[model samples]
Structures are given as C-alpha cells and as structure tokens.
Target: MHIENADLNLLKALDVLLEERHVSRAAARFHLSQSAMSRTLTRLRETFGDELLVRTTRGYELTPRARAIRQELEFILPRLRAMVRGGDFDPATSTDAIRVNCTDYAISILGPGLLPHVFERAPNLSLTIEPLSPRTYDEIEHGRVDLALSPVQPPAGLRWQPLFEEDYVGVVAADHPLTADRLTLDEIREFPRVSVVVLPQEQMVIDRRLAELGVAQRSGLRVPYFEAAFTALPGTRLIALVPRRLVEARRADHSVRLVEAPTELAAPFPYGMVWHPRLNSDPAHVWVRSKVGEVAAGLRPGTP
Candidate 1:
C-alpha cells in the first residue's frame, strides 16, 4: 500500500471508529456529528476496499482484515499522535497506558512503591500489570508488553538492563528458633521448607545455584506466588527462602523474621528489565524504565 497518497485524516477517523465500534461513539470521540462520522466511515471503506467494521448484534465487529490491521494501528497511531503533537513527552500532561509483565515477587517487592512515583510524575499515565506467562520472552519480542521485570536473562534480540540484585534470605515466624542464630545451609536443609516455584528459566538459575552450594532441602510445600509462600509461613514450622527485599516489605505487617543465609547459599539474584529493541526508542517506555531503575536503586540491600 502506497501511503504517500493516502488521506491522513481518514487514518485518524478509522482509528477512532475502530476503537469506538459505533457511529455515535466514534462521532463523540472525534467531536463530529453522526452524519459526518458515517461519511468518514464510507471514505474509509473506499480507501481500504473493505467494510472494515461490520454490524453485530452486540456491537460492531472487525473483519479478519480489520483485526489484522488493528495492531498495526495501535503501533502507528501513537507515533502519529506524537509527531503531530511535536513529539513532546510531557509526563505531567500526556496520558499513556503502559503494559508490564512481571512475577508476583517483583510486584510485591517493587510495584507498590514504584506505582506511586510513576503516578506522581505522570498522573495521566495508566498501568497494566500482566502475569508473567511461561512464554514471557515471546511476549516481549512480539510487543505484547512494554516491559518485563524478571530474574531470568532475556532471550536474543531483546535488550536487558540489570535493575537490582536480590539475595536469598530465610524467613520464618518472629518466634522461630533459628531467628536468633545465623541460618546455616545444613539447618535450612534439615527443616520443612516452603519454596516458591517460578517459571522454568528462573528455576534453572535457582537450581544451578543450589547445586553449586550443595544445598538440598525437603520441600514442605511448593507455591506459585510469593504472597502464598509468605502467608504459609505465619502458622507452620516451615521456613521459606525468599528475596530479602520481599521479606523486609512484609516485616511490619507480619511477625516474620528474616535471617541471612550462609554466604554460599546467598547467591545474588539479579532482576532485570527486558524490552524489545523496537521499543528502545519509545519515550514513554524509556521514562518508565528509568523510574523503575531509580526505585530499584533506592531499594538497595537494607533500604526496602
């Protein structure tokens, strides 16, 4: 398709109609009368050589061609808006939604504090916290999310920036016996342990670290999320090996005690921010990444 002779106004009209999926709503979005919007839709059909949107019982539905082009519009419309607005990224004024994928641990440790800072800086900005799915690398590569924060290394073709290094700590109830003494690898291995089973990539790194230290323990329970692991610790005699930052965050609310693990078992678990190269130049994404890095820096060893 030769975009050189295309009507740019029609592109904007199509974008609004596709999003609203109704003539009246699309007219309201563009501040046009319903008749004007209908005319715009007709022009769009002629330009695209397709009905694009077909009426449905519930609402308007996109044809397969329209569905295929929806993502392209999502990507292109933002850039077009930026260009028309003189490419200014005024955080205080610009309203943008950023999608981020991360584990429950990252959200517990970093999300609470980071969100407020982001809102303060960019009040109009919205956030979508997506689950860190098994196919996270593919999600990042295909632009399903703006950024990903995880302990795993990024796959090829993606860029990774190290945010912070977390270390494993032994967590138990405040009155647990080992809270008074430094936790030894042998002692940790002897007791029932609550382990948070992450994705395969993270599991590989943790397993490698445990093997290096010869640390083997009987798993009392395996949970999918960190909050579950933390919740399981208050009543049981089970000890949980979790990130120190997470333990510190929950210390005030829960009567949990954090004991440093033996140096050999206290491997540095580095969490990083990964994004596709295509988004490397996106201003909003860069701003969000920088803010996340800043929050991570402040959460250093004992500050969380």
Candidate 2:
C-alpha cells in the first residue's frame, strides 16, 4: 500500500472525480489538462486498487469503495478546513461567494432582505442563488451548496432548523370571480390551474396532494417559481396556489389578489435552512444562518 511521492492532490482529484463522475468536469475543477487528469486517474486506480469510477452507458457510476472514500472525506476534510479557517466573520470584508441552493420562492423571500446586509457589509460579496435540483443532500455535504432554503423536509443525516410555517392561498386576477370570497375546494378544483413546478424533493408531496384532490392545472402554464405564477394569473382564468409569503414579497406587482384556499385543501409546511453537520463550526456560515433565522422568524406565517 506504499507509493512513492504521494501527493494530496491525488486524493482531492479522486474526491472531485467521484462527485462529478465525469473526467472532463473533474479535470476542469483541478485545472488540469485532460491527459494529465487521465494520468492522475490512473495513479488513483493503482493506489486504491479499485476503479473508483466505472463508466456506464449513460455516464460514470461510483463503486461502493468510492462511496466509502467519499464518506470518509466528508467526515474529515471540511472539519479540518473549518478548524484552520474558522474565525470572526466580517460580512463587510467577506468577498467569498456564498452559494445558496433554493427555489425562486426562496430567492424572493431571502435575497432582497439579505442583499442590503450583503451590500452594506460585504460590498464585494457575490450571491449565487439557484434552483434546488436532485441530490440536494449530497450537494450540501460536498460543499457544492453552502446553504439551502426549502419547503421540502430535509433527508436524514442533514441538519435543519424550521424557519416558519407557511400557508398556501389561491391567487388570481384582481377582478377574478374566485376572489369574491374564500375559495371552496370545488371552486379551486374547477378553475384552470397554473401549477407551481418545484424541486424533486417538493414534487412528490405536491403531486400526491393534487392526485388526492383530483385536480389538474389545465391552464397549461406550468412554472418553477411563484413569481411566474403571479405573472400568469392576472387578466386570465388561470388560478395559482402559492405561499402567502410570495404575495407579500410581490404585493407591489399589483397584478393579482390572494384569497384563502378552502380549509380542507390547504396544507402548511415549514420553510427553513438546511446544512450538513460538517459546517457546524464554520463561523461565516453560522453568522449568515443566524441572519436567515432572524428574517424567517420575523415573517410570521398567515394571510399576507
């Protein structure tokens, strides 16, 4: 098991390769030439005595050995980094780009409120906010996502803090007949629906609820964010069920009005921040996370 001139970069390379599961992508991450990366992969295989990434018809798949390696790395590396780097975090001087994986709904809720702080404190700070896609837990543990704001509950092994409970409401044109009063489930079911397309984690719950209610979004305007739903609802027969927070966020848009969904049809879920335990002691993460909690707490849940 002894090798000459063992370089730490090899382990780093293996880690990235297992994560990306694509040679070119991993090579780009390490800024290595394609042929150089291939040589590094060869060395990794020789050292580990396992084909860490085996190519499949669609793409590369990790062996169980690779998964074990990843788990080990996930346990050790970030905590080591945190120990070395942890300190008082001055948002004013922080230029590190904080990547938050979330839906547009989260962006609407967090970005504006956080930006003033981001600007006033960390003027050079850049925020990259994007949709929550598949393998969210893996992404968070691997440092691919610095934070997540999701309505969908976190999977086991991920740590989460519930920010607030949110209630769903029906929104339509200001003059839409459905706004005459709180909507009955029958009225909601009969309306042409504009569904909110969400991440994979949230998709199942949504689909299950819709199936149980026997309702379909017939308006044919399916969108990933509630903002799009707001845009679609005005001056049309389309009805959208979205978080009351969304209406509060975009109330100035003045394109739609919100009414309560029938009590039987609406369900409440907590939207919160989730992160990996590896980041537990990261000072910068702790500070911003607290700010997020403060914002979420102030946003008491109810009709906008």
- Give the top-scoring candidate (TM-score): 1
Q: lDDT of model 1 at residue 137? A: 83
RMSD of each: 3.4, 6.3
Q: Against the unseen true structure, what C-alpha lDDT does each candidate score?
A: 0.78, 0.75
> What tens-digit string does per-residue lDDT give for candidate 2 at 118-150?
578668765677778877767887776778888
Error of 2 at 135 (Å): 2.4
Worst 10 residues of 2 by lDDT: 74-83
Rate residue 101 of model 1 by lDDT: 86
lDDT of 1 by residue, 55-172 (tens): 9898899988887677667656665666665646889986666778887888887877798889988998868887787887887776657788988888788999998887777788
TM-score of each prediction: 0.80, 0.69
